[model samples]
Target: MQSRRSRTSISISQQRMLSHSMTGLSLEQQKMLYYVGVDVGTGSARACIIDSMGNILSLAERPIQRQQLKPNFITQSSQEIWQSVCHCVKSVVRDSGVPSEKIHGIGFDATCSLVVVEEKSNKEVAVGPDFSNTDQNIILWMDHRAIEETAEINATGDKCLKYVGGQMSVEMEIPKIKWLKGHLPDNKFAECKFFDLADYLTFKASGKETRSFCSTACKQGLLPVGVEGSTEGWSRDFFHQIGLDELVEDDYRRIGGSVKNDNKGKNFLSAGEFIGAIDESVAEELGLSNHCVVGSGVIDAYAGWVGTVAARTDVSLPALAKSDREKVGIDRATGRLAAVAGTSTCHIAMSRDPVFVDGVWGPYRDVMANKFWCAEGGQSCTGALLAHVLTTHPAYTELSQLADAASVSKFDYLNSRLESLAHQNKARSVVHLAKHLFFYGDYHGNRSPIADSSMRAAIIGQSMDNSIDDLALMYLGACEFIAQQTRQIVEKMTVSGHNLSTIFMSGGQCRNGLLMRLLADCTGLPIVIPRYIDAAVVFGSALLGAVASESFDKSGAKSAISASRKSSIAGDLSQHNPKNSLAKFGGIGGDDLPSPYTAPSATASTSQIATVGFPFPAPDDVQEEQFDEDEESGSELNFKAQSKWKKDMEDRMKGRSSDNGDTMWNVMYTMTGSGKVVQPCAESHPDRVLLNTKYKIFLDMADTQRKYRQMVDAVE
Candidate 1:
């Protein structure tokens, strides 16, 4: 089973003998270069290097270890996490000297964790029997050792456990492959392989044993449900009801019969052939360039959500632009949920439909937004419950020695000692003693609603004065118990269908602005905030290496090989799927649709298109840079005009009026505003698109808004 280029053929034959002792150097020749991303978390193993305008240029890390043995077993060592992912990809190409044949495409992301891989003859075995057999295999993503095989696959109430929200999660990989086929039944023929630490690091870099629907639907619950047609793969009667029915024999070849494809699909392979070379024995032990292109893998939070939403062009030009200028609803398949928040919090989201959201795990497909369907759900501990309410209180080492003699950081000297003991107070009166300190949060147990890993933690408003002002009101009630457990999974993903509007946030408790205004006053919405916060996962892994090197159409032309061929494009359409509706615009009913479950712009005339809603005060003085290591230093992406902040978002919704008797119909009848607006009746597309100005501002609103202000002051 050794193949990621013959088990990293000594780093691609010692970087092809150092690229024939360095030939033709035009400053290390570049037509296009660098894109590696590897991730593997839950205790380190990173690698970044990015370029092609999404920027990063260098980064590395190693760690991994994780043992525990009892108190609910944990183990790891797929040969010590692939030798700590080849010592963090040979220390991020020896601290980015750049010339690994000018690196092209390579991606990877991890921590859905579960690698085992066994079949070796010429070498490599031991997934562990302890006693330093040393090959140590791998299990970790907080390994619980399948708590009774995840309560016997949730006692088979299975309808694929209602697409994961119904529960099975002993943190996935079908309860760690039914606790390794019922305790290693003689090492079950030393199980050829299983993988998921980003499909065992793209089967250890391109010996390509494929499998990433972001690791078969977030750690093998695998359900795309439907995007088109639907021969729903991976489910041999739900893996013979969790016994893993020998991974449906032959064709599955022990988990990797193929299906990797990143951006669009098919074996499209281009981070330009892993920026060509490297793996010639990992290019003679990381000197690099056995032909450089090592890409097509992702998972470290979908390569940090494609390097933190590739420096916003409404979220990286609708996912790395130029597919005839891609744009559709929810910015082409909803993403935003992000969250990250340090010391545990993931959340995520993304949708082009498949939604299963119960307690949330995922519909997964395309991992981090390609064709869509992600899900996720987090809070295994929000900033470890604000460092367990400031280091288990009792005035945490005297408020960390008066915040280390005022060099600040006991949460900035406890917010300057609650702003000098609230001298006429207001951070909303210290967030109302953080609503009487109630945090029952099962510490590290309840992963998603109640995937309960030994239900432990409990705190509920204690007392008898342990001052430092009761540890600053129990650290603002553990940051409002991590924003009321992410507003109880946004009220269970709005009853499991999801139409959620805003919340983007990032890690390190999003550098706490009173914990991002108490998660925007406990999820009432509006959070966006990514004007480049330490490269959101390295600009979402350098926009997946500029969409695997087509480099946003400056004509390198490949665009990650989108697999087509099934188009006979029929339409009598009505199966009625307005994509899991919460309708912020998605329609198709007909005969001026006002019902048949509303849409065709929810009933039409929309001034043949010219809309605009609340656009007020648009300019925030643009200038948000951070494209490090220079691909011409970031943000020049105007993508062909529209600014003056896109025509002041069309004169702030046509200079708002309804002649004072205000209602604006409960702010356009809330689904969080901007409710009815849909366009694309196609008079050659863009006439100031926002679905043709939200269907000509709701057909110049005569049904009210006071007969659209006397039909716009009788056409002015």
Candidate 2:
């Protein structure tokens, strides 16, 4: 097979798009200048065309194909992805009736998955044996096939790891590269160039070495730009120490050379820097004018930040903490942390100064659009977990039938069914159904403050009621836990010195009303859903392009007209105040709230709600309060379920760890990496009891991971 240069030829699909008069008169309804933003996500590629006013004129999506070669390993084709992008761009422009010449610039954002190619020809390489097609060389970001490599790299304690929330994981590029060397030493893996998926798209689109600081510094675990001593970029000593010394001497050309001091001074570009116009031949093939500038690309999450807080209608100093004028994504102001939820969810919090948070990734300088430092907390699975919950249940077929009967999608049915349940039980609402169930949500391992890459999920309070309603209740429980996980991250960040009071959210998951409500309820904080929740990330990409192309200026009258800013954005809160529950679990007093890191929880369920916390609900349901009674005081249903879930999780770790096979730690890697064993759950009730019980679970989870990791890397 011959190595082929990127953009050597446009695919037939792209050509078909150009041939059709797709950009018809509707797009020509007005002769307005527009910018296009392209967001390449795990499931699809979306493009949005926005006029100078920042209002979207048209939006379109093209699904990208993914192949799961094996358990815990996923692969994709960059060619397929690029074709999807072109299709979406043309579709949006056509639907909006925007002329090709009116499009000023385009910006791209994508998952931080790794793309591997031949360095010289920019041709895709065969990533693994299960893939027969060499062009399927992009490794999905969620792949965890490099656990052993990740452990080895972490053992070196390289300074770069510090930028990644104090530990490294198999999801990042360094470990993936190490896995490539260890597993396929003689194959294409050994001789390849790597680009975090964002840069890969930029290179494919503009045919230049364009890399954004957001993806390069934030997700790849590189030394963050603007950190005091990181001007030299990659640390050769750390590379040699980890036994991957080959990456050191030749200026680390395979992984990233644009940042190496020797490579034409092509250091990281801010999210808004225009990388130049799209390649002329490619632009023609995709029906775009040669003048359409392509802006530097950003990780999909940072792009979410752009659309949510920095959109055109929004002139307020966005959530950029405090920083200089030149940075992208950075505004003169800051407020809420933004949660971009999809397959995996990331919580992005910005602070004026660097805050060293344990287990959370970042504190990366200039990475948040060159303004405030960034702290990222994430869950490995969110929407994916909920899908598993809905599909695997016995009621799934019935639910689907019901949904089809009602002429709605399954997810939409999920919402309607829950509302029906609330309507059926006059004394209770959806909250009543959720109270009967609980979930751990980390079936794919913990990715935030707990930082365990090997953690499995757990469920409690399941009943023999295999009805669709039962499934709905279980789904509600799963959403609750996902929200709680975010709450845990928020608490951890608050303890580490952030003054966040609200969360601004984007992505597919936010479209689920129950999810947004539950998150607000569990965290006891306001949850702000941007107008275009489903395409906020895509819109954010356009915002970057608009800024890059000078269609949207930050210092313009629109911004200056609304200079006064409030500390928090307001939103609807859940009827139940879960802060009492959070406070109890976090272990702060009911009267005075102290940072959990310094004060710590004393016992379960005793912590106090922050004085400025969730809106106090007019006491509606007393069941949550009733559970606070001693073990001898209630029906023991909730208590028993909670206990059962804990025991199953501990047993899962014990059983999996005892094996000596290659999958000995499969439970940890795929689900979780907990270390301790405790007796069966004890039936108990009380806000204090619940809080203490859950806290113990968190502690055990953390301890389990530490012990297991130590065991794996022992000096045998």
Question: lDDT (CA) for every model shown?
Answer: 0.50, 0.62
Q: Could you tell me the TM-score of candidate 1?
A: 0.29
Models 1 onward score TM values of 0.29, 0.72
User: Using alpha carbons, what is the TM-score of model 2?
Assistant: 0.72
Writing each residue's lDDT as its tens digit, candidate 1 over 1-716 gives: 32122112122212222332354654222322455666666776666665432334566677877777665566666666667767766777777666665554455666776777664531333444363444556666666767888888888776656666777678777787677776664555345567777666655654545465666667676554353323444566767876777777864567665342232223212111122222345544544443444444555655544433312222222222342134333343254566665557777766666777666776665554345567778767777777877887878999988888888678867766665655545434455544445555456676765455655555656889898977887786666566666767776776777766556665545545566665665555555444334335533443444343221211211111112211121121111112211111111011111212112221233243212221111112222222223233132223122122222222332322211101111111111111111111234323223222332332232124445546788999
How do the residues 1-716 of candidate 2 rate in per-residue lDDT, one tens digit apiece?
44322221222112212222244544323323467889999989888887543456788888898888688788888989989888998888888766776676688899989888887888888677454577788888988888988899888887888888888867777888788776654565556777988898888877777567777677666674346476556677777787776666566666565354332335566666645556766776667765566777888987876666431112122332232233322332244577888888988877778787888988776564444577888888898998899989999999989989999878889888888888878634566655545566688888888887777766667778898888888887787778778878988889988777557777767557677766765565656555565767887787667555542222122221122321221221111122122111111111222211111111112222222222222112211111223434232223343334223222322211101111101101111101111111223423224434554564465566568778887965
Q: What range of 10 consecutive residues in model 1 has the weakest lDDT sum?
A: 660-669
Per-candidate clashes, comma-separated: 61, 31
**Model 2 stretches with alpha carbons more than 4 Å out:** 1-31, 185-190, 224-228, 258-265, 311-333, 419-428, 551-716
